[model samples]
Target: MAQETANSQENSNDLGTITVEAEALSIVTEGTESYRAPLTSTATRLDLTPRETPQSVSAVTQAQIEDFNLDTINDALESTPGVTVERVETDRTYYSSRGFEISNLQVDGLRLPMPYNNVHGDIDTAVYDRIEVVRGATGLMSGSGNPAATVNFIRKRPTDSPQASVSGTLGSWDRRRLELDVSGPLDDEGRVRGRLVAAGLDTDSYLDRLHRERGVLYGVLEADLTDSTQLALGHTWQNNNTDSNMWGALPLYDSAGSPTNYDRSTSPAPDWSYWDGETHRSFVELTQRLSDNWSIKGTVTHLDMLSDTKLFYIGTVPDASTGRIPNSFYLSKFDRHLEQWVADIHAKGNIEAFGRTHQLVLGSDWSQSRVQQSSLYAAATEDLPPLDEWDGSYPEPEFGDPDFVHDVTFKERSLYSAGKLDLANRWTAVVGARLSWLDHVGEQYGSSQDTTLDNELTPYAGLIYDVTDQASLYASYTEIFNPQTATDRNGDFLDPIEGTSYEVGIKADVFDGGADAALALFRTEQNNVAQLVGNIGGRDVYEGADGITSEGVDVTLAGELTPGWQASVGYTYLEIEDAEGEATNTYIPRNMVRATTSYRPASLDALKVGARVRWQDDIERERDFDDSKTRQEAYALVDLMASYDINENLTASLNLNNVTDEKYLTSLKWDQGFYGAPRHVMANLTWRY
Candidate 1:
């Protein structure tokens, strides 16, 4: 029996496919830039191959992650097509897709809530094996969110055989990094297994007086209770510390509405300013097999985050001659504790019905999350030192004890079910629905308010037809619901935003699944979208827009283009409009294209080289009440990378990003322009045993 089990494991590993519960726990994907992902449960809650599902899905494989040096989630998302990354501040970044913000994130198919205004999205990639992205609404899996996209992270697991590796990196701007990973069997018969990963980063930014330190640790253990049952437990911890972080961007325009030119290294933060954030997560999963064709799995997770900062808030357009600007100095601290419990059980099998064989899945899930948050701030608005030359030197001001600000709480409970069936001929069908209940409360020093939403159901449906052996056409419709925290003019919580999305696409696997291509057209309609109306009684009042619509076309081709070359290319065109037929969400580009390709020559044998390019069209922004408008011209950035294998165990790589050093602004909001990174060069060395 042991020998048979060992053979089964070896076969599964070689194919990168899971054959049993144990095999699912420790399978690694191979290939540097492959577009073919065999299995993903993020879209349907059932482990179906990517092409078999009627939705658009993309997997950023482990080989691609390492080849691109995607050290953080931000880096990975920036490289992904049909997605836009906006850097709000030094430590905060936001991602959007299809003209809407992406607010849903999952780990191992478990949905987790992340705050947009906090540091939760700045996750490190050391603990993850792959990132799966599903474009369009994933309402059946994610309880409440916009119809943008869902990103699922798959964590690394212990391997059947012992494996160890170490890596070091040196980069521009005083950047240094080190990482270690080890995984193997922990006991006889390989019933128990363990894995550990640790990494540290110390980097100085291109901006003046800005430096950062980051640390990450992840550990996991898996045990086989029986031949058909398994259990796994894991935890991840990450912390980030920064010195001299800016609260906002440099001045966009002077008092005369003329654009200001400042050095790329210019920053408004003083030397004494700092920000720190920490996150910890723990999770458990279990899998049981009842029959040869039937199996079930369950997972639970807990997450906590804390943050603190002292900043010199820069405000007001500066004088072009004197360079004097208004400054507000303050110290703030925030503590957010979230406890989430989720339970799910499902059975899958093939049954003969009506003279045909069909795959059926029946499952139900229940989840509840509670968040408790509080914050305090100490401020001094008067007697600030300024009206001088632009420099990184400033005197620290005395601050008293922080005052009580507010206390807030939020909760969500959801139940969902989904299924997939093979219809007659080459046609397939998928259907699912979810019911959710949400509640929230906020107490501001002495005032409090409560809001609730009960029993809302979101539905999903899709149809697919296999046109040929290598091509399939599909169409899907999905819905989404998201509650808003913004208040109306009456001081009452605004109604939840409701969205419906329609998508039609064709996917093809070429070269015996060595490459994949997809073309999709989508339209999304959103109602009750909250928009800031004005300030009433010193409080902001928001009103819902009548409707917003986003229509777009996306084309992607990835995997091996030829025998010795791999490439991924994507293009996107989007149009968004409000109820009045006026353009909306103009910050996001209307036309964008990205391409990445790598080549390993048959002659060199040990040398590999690659190049990447990203281009976006011009974007225009118009204020709600003003006639003045701002426009960011179109631009393209280029990158290059090369690697040389010294031996079977040693490898060296070099990467140069922003080769042209383009000075275009990546984000322009409220008259402030955030410049993109100028240029970066990173070199890495790795050894394996």
Candidate 2:
């Protein structure tokens, strides 16, 4: 849908060109309808525009979400530059950046842990105003993670004036979607504001017998108390349920290690198979402004997740000539519940140091989680079908009591502080550190384990030199901490993996800050990483190696080009090697590119058109059941969009994805994988008030 810019830009040289004082709209992108972000705080916890930050940052705005029809978290991050979305299963996904997996996700700057180090459900993006990504280790602001990247979701907030929108979508594969969003003040004096968003989707898939249903609801209330203090409370809920969901993808090769050229729609899932997930989150925050430039905030949050799945897997390879394929007969059913709670307090302000004003932030946070899971396996009642003649028609299994159960608890507490100092007229420096303590206790599959690590410290430092009003040069060093559960050959738990990152870059606010550009060179290292040894008594032992090293170059640009033209583009070049100096993480592409742009012509005032192009180099993975490797060649995809205003309060839009119909595997992370969706089309109609 065509949207109007919420904020205006007046001059090119003024650093304080736009003023946003309210905490609710501190870094607002709700109604901006543009890709360029005015401010970001993910890297430092201090409000700073993207140009002023030392690290590489990127954003997917509401406009991009609307234009590209980014329905799920996977779709949004998949198009993001420098990010790789790995779809290992129908409902599970893993994201990576800079050749390492992203370990955490944040909502409104608060970390929310995931289940099993993977995304379980299809997270809808309708309630979010924008998504921001900060590349590299962020130990100062974020508690702990890899050196890949951090994703922070910005929720849509109540507007000063009342507004509402309703939209419906229809697409290929009998897909349908509906959404409603509204925001306004709660009282005549506008002291209290409220906002609510809801959406639902039901869709069939290109893969046979795969169907999905998803729903989302979010609501928030903000109250201004005593003119200087503010209180806000919010809740969000989402559910994803799918039928005929495959436990794994179609077999990539036959019994002889030769590639199996199965049709893209082929699948091994039975009609009775399903995977369902639900998540609930509630949060409350209180903020107090002490002065014109100083503020303090405290927050508490709780999250709950539940999952149920009935899955089937066929690991044995097929024999095309003999039609003598032997499918695994053991099916499984799982039920899991995870709960987490977190609390944090932070203060940010300006201080006069060394005769110049500087920025500082201090914070402390605590989190704990409890997880319980159980599973049961059922033997196949009957099986008599060849690969060529098999459909998703099968009888449901009669599952008995759970035969395996696990219970675990994890706790972490941390304290962090950071400061940005003005060293000279053209130079600046940022320094920070974090101290954390972690504890884990669990009983898993009849094994008892307990681990603790205390006083873990990670440091961060950066220097920036202003080359001109529009450009700056910078270098930074950061580190992250990750505890391991693997055991060494001596039956001793290994130490935590320590990730260190080094980077140098240049940033420019070109076109008078209408557009932004950045170029960065980065390298990262991990130590004490686990390496496997021979198994003993059905238990695999491991050894700690020096781990791996990744180095890369990244370039990004995003902003309004002209009157009605906007573009966001990025390119990445990466190389990763292990201790032996051989290529590693070969499943991740070494070269990737993402480019998108949109334009609204003055002559065609009511029309807007846009396109997005994505390209990646070849990627390969060594098969687990065999020594052979599965490889997917380089390919490109093209997606197109167009929108037209039918009236003052109505708009119509259409999106076409994979227009070239390029066939490619979703990922090679596992020996079995499926192809991506084919050329698809969708149309949307929205009404606003």
Give the winner by lDDT. 2
lDDT of 2 by residue, 406-478 (tens): 9988888999888888999989888889899989899778776577989999898999999999899999999
Which residue pairs collide in model 2, if any?
none
Please give the range of 10 consecutive residues that has the lowest summed lDDT in model 1: 1-10
The candidate that wins on TM-score is 2
| C-alpha lDDT score of every prediction, in listed order | 0.74, 0.83
lDDT for residue 177 in candidate 2, whole number 0-100 = 100
Candidate 1 lDDT score at position 610: 87
TM-scores, all models, native as reference = 0.91, 0.95
Candidate 1 global CA lDDT score:
0.74
Q: Could you give candidate 1's per-residue lDDT for residues 540-655 as a string of tens digits?
A: 89998867789999898777877768777789899988888989889899998877778889899688888878899998776332366677889999988998889978989999
TM match of model 1 to true structure:
0.91
